[model samples]
Target: MRKFILCSALVLVMTALSGAAVMAAKPVDNDGDGVTERSDCNDNNALIYPGAAEICTDGLDNNCDGLIDRADPTCTAGVCSDADGDGYGFPADPSCSYTQEDCNDTLASINPGASEVCDNGVDDNCDGLTDTADPACGTNPHASNTWQNYPLDCLSCHDQQFNEMADSTHYWWVGDTTEMANQNGTLQGKLTNSVNSYCINILGDWPVCGKCHVGRGKRPDDPQADKTNIDCLACHNEDYAMARTRLADGSMAPSLAGVENPTAEELQVLDGYTQNINAPTRKNCLKCHAFAGGGNAVKRGDLSMSGTDLHGATLLEGTDNNSDPNFDVHMNVMASDLKCQSCHVFQNHKTIGRGSDLRPTDDLARGSEVKCVTCHAGFDVDGGHAAAGANRTDADRHVSKVACQSCHIDHYAKVATELNRDWRYSHDGTPADGTNGPGHPELTIGEDLSPVYKFWNRLSDNYLLGDVAVIDPETGAYPTSRPIGDINDGKLYPFKYKTGVQPMVSSDSKLVALDTYEYLAGSGDVDQAVQSGLVNMGYPSTEPVEWVTTDTYQLLNHGIAPAANVDCAKCHGDLDLATFSELDNLGYALKGPKAQICSQCHREKNLKSDHPGMHNHVDKGVGMDCLFCHSFSRQEERGGISPCDSNATDFVDTNPFAHPECSQ
Candidate 1:
């Protein structure tokens, strides 16, 4: 019976399919020709005999007309006339009028060829005007920025702004500024507008001299031999560049005109959107300094590793291999590449003195390194900038010294992993953020990264916090606080430069060294530099250096608990082996104020997953500081010139961990 039923069903399906094959499609006919569609010569029109008026429609004889489709809209329709007349259609059919050939119906503009006037609110014909505002006049209203439409030429109201530019260093590149003695006291000098005037004279251009000369510009003498023009190629050169440049994996940031991103057909379009983004502003300086590495190192762009490196590896029991030498720094440096602007900023001490207080030059040339006393305001005072002048050795030092940017570069934004499609056309298209996780990072970024841990389950529920601890009711102190000053090492060696060990701090709160891109680029590594002549700034060696002491920092004694049961009785308890992982959440094993511990990472630049593991977690690359990567306990912050660190500590002599980037 089952066999019979299957055969019956198959027969029924076959019959239904056969019926569909015989049916034909529907038809279109402007003229009504009714010969049952199949036999009719013109399926659209019955009114057209073998020969009749050209009543259009049907691909045949409509009204017996020989023409096809050219009826109602053309000769046959009551208004027998072509509007476009190109033999096309009304709007599209170009038959009635060729004037319809004019593509732009709005401005009534016509013809394939015409003048190309950019819509810059101006009429170029010398025929006075723009956008019909002025009738083709001889001149245009110049670029203005005044309460009453002030013209671009500032002379309209003010005198030729500081015309002595021919003699000024800022205007013509000639010399240097005087220096001061200390950060405190009125760093005296002539507070005149003469220097300011020099800049205003040549102010018509984007570079007021002060724009790029950076340290000097209008402030110092740039000299004729080294007269530099503010050219785009100087910074955004494809091969050799000073400023960070951009390229598009997917046009995230096509090179600006004046900038490098150019097409083969033509170089930067004559004044395109290219020059829109401003020249090096203080903000631009920060962009490079904020980050490190291709992305690992950064300037103003800061990241949080707590200690975890770029690839998410942590210094735990089994991950960090001790045998390797560079293992620690390679793995834990946060934003390994540091930028110059990160430290050389306005109102910041790194500028010549401990603060806005700049001093004049002494008789020597150092990397301009000093703690408190540096820039004097002017050049005619007893102990002020008046006492300052170019140091005799300044020329040699400029030639030899790598002030910064010797390595790190603010790489342009990268194309994120996104679908390849014209945004308007994509089915599920999402615009990509110009930067990726690491490709473009800030050099000195702060994180509000609330999540402590994200387990393999791909969720944030299992995050860790540094080992939690409660204040002793008796003493309200926490393990973190400002570190006391110390002359860890008194003897000074002639200064030597080393790179790769990401920085953790600066001397006297000046420049945050390792935290910059320069540090990560392996600046003056030991092999490239002499491990000699480094001098110690602590010549008097007044204070004693202190080593890490758990007894001093109360939180260091406690530890983290397991992932799942983190909030239970485990949280309040004193640290033991089980609670150690909690440190991964708070981002450290240190027990100090956030500043004390935060600065640890603030120094180093690179932090890849491969660095020496610090605590006992996977180092998800989010919860760690610079110390976890630099083996900070071993390295010293160089203040006075020094070939090698006087306070360099040989960690564990029995090394417990190693960063991945460190080669033999």
Candidate 2:
């Protein structure tokens, strides 16, 4: 009887198994996601369905549109998150009920958390109704202004925006510096570490430098991932000012030195924050840039307080109605409503255009967008241009090989600026505010100075914190900034010549950036500062140090001369002794190609020995066509003062007088 019952159960199980196999032959959700195969675009992904919102820029066909990347609008600008696939998204409350208020929209298990308890008549969430009377809330909820709850309150709402800022170079101060290939360190910037002619490295002086940093109260050692460290008001608030603490010695005390996090007392200063912050103003940027290297116009010769307002009422006329044309051409407000942002173009918080002395030169691996050619559009000028007289044929020939600022800018630092600053001399008294103002004494000021010219390919060898200082034997100083180029590499550029007298390790001959914050705040304790600075830079402080002078070059970008007033004879003359001597030293065959060919014209005409002979050559024999020596090409004759292969050591002369075909 037991065997017969077992047989009957086995038969029943066989019948059910056969029935399921037959049903499997039909269309089904193969990957086990909710929808059927035909309805689900990505049947394998349960999260992807016909009504699902799109993800962007990850090289995926998120919306099942076949197209990828930037082709989708979802990649451009969209809601930060929509984890639950609830048609409604979080972060962006789209008038739909399924937005952020629902804590776990995916698990319909949770909605908005229970409301605040009615212990008092106040509204915790700032809602209009009080406590129990508020219909939008429940009772017995826990909440406060504690740090534990802050992340959920703020970070959850704007995580993406914060992430963008956190990833930016402005925040990290350390990124891929492909532009600074010549530097010794892998990470670079004012934050990571840079040794400038002025102020030097910021390793031990975060509080002083942090005054200009975008983030709130962050020192050099702050964690890069701390989103709360961002200080939004610093750049946006017009009324927000950097309040500093000064010591009895008239030096600004470093705020929160050696402190990891800001205290409640430190935060109270920002309690009266401005709500309606605007875009960055000139005043905001100038607070730090204009005063770099200790004081106003101390580091950059092209920039000064005076250049900020170089425009006048007749600016649109393209003529200087208010002041000198050579002060500042681009930033003059009278000509247009332009600002620093106009040329510096910011995207995702990264500003374009780097200084020639800094990074982002023309040869940068991944280049910058800010450029003069953006608006100027090379060589398309008319008489309306300020430098209209510069359009002569002779000058136009050099345009391809010379930067505009090289010739147009006669001089820089129209206003007084420091030509040199020597920090080797010890100050025993109270340290002056060495960063700026009345106390610091190591400065040499100069005005209306001529710039040094160099062929710049936009490459440079910047000194790092520990590199051996490349000192000039004559000057006995290291170059803080130098532009690199060659005749075949790029064009001639004008730069402000700067010199500095600073400290260096005598034993290793390595350049050292001393920590001045502690020294200045400690009433000029040089020994303490040097030892601390060495420790901060990861070097032994036992090494002997000595004072040395160094030279740096900053490219001149201001003080453009009008073409109408510029005298061409200064650079271009048939036989001007001073002009020829200067051009020869700079590798220019300015005397009409060869010194030998020049004798042919003078000898044939028997021109006078004294006075300018360009008049005699042209008026008597060459028929005043000056084109013979100036223009490179005319109808049947070869012209131009220099050979086409300027970089070649030797070449067949291509002149009308020596032309093999013409002579025959």
| Residue 352 C-alpha lDDT in model 2 | 59
Task: Score every model by TM-score.
Answer: 0.21, 0.59
| Candidate lDDT (C-alpha), each | 0.24, 0.53
Write model 1 residue lDDT over 497-536, tens digit each, in one string: 1111111112221111111111112231311111110112
Best by lDDT: 2
Among all windows of 10 consecutive residues in model 2, the one with the lowest summed lDDT is: 310-319
For model 2, residues 490-549, the per-residue Cα lDDT tens digits are 678888887776678887877777776765444445566677777776678776788787
Residue range with the least summed lDDT across 10 consecutive positions in model 1: 550-559
Measured with C-alpha atoms, the lDDT of residue 592 in candidate 1 is 39
- Error of model 1, residue 516, in angstroms: 11
Q: Note the residue pairs that clash in candidate 2.
A: 387-563, 432-439, 477-549, 618-624, 631-640, 632-639, 632-640
Q: How accurate is candidate 1 locally (lDDT)?
A: 0.24
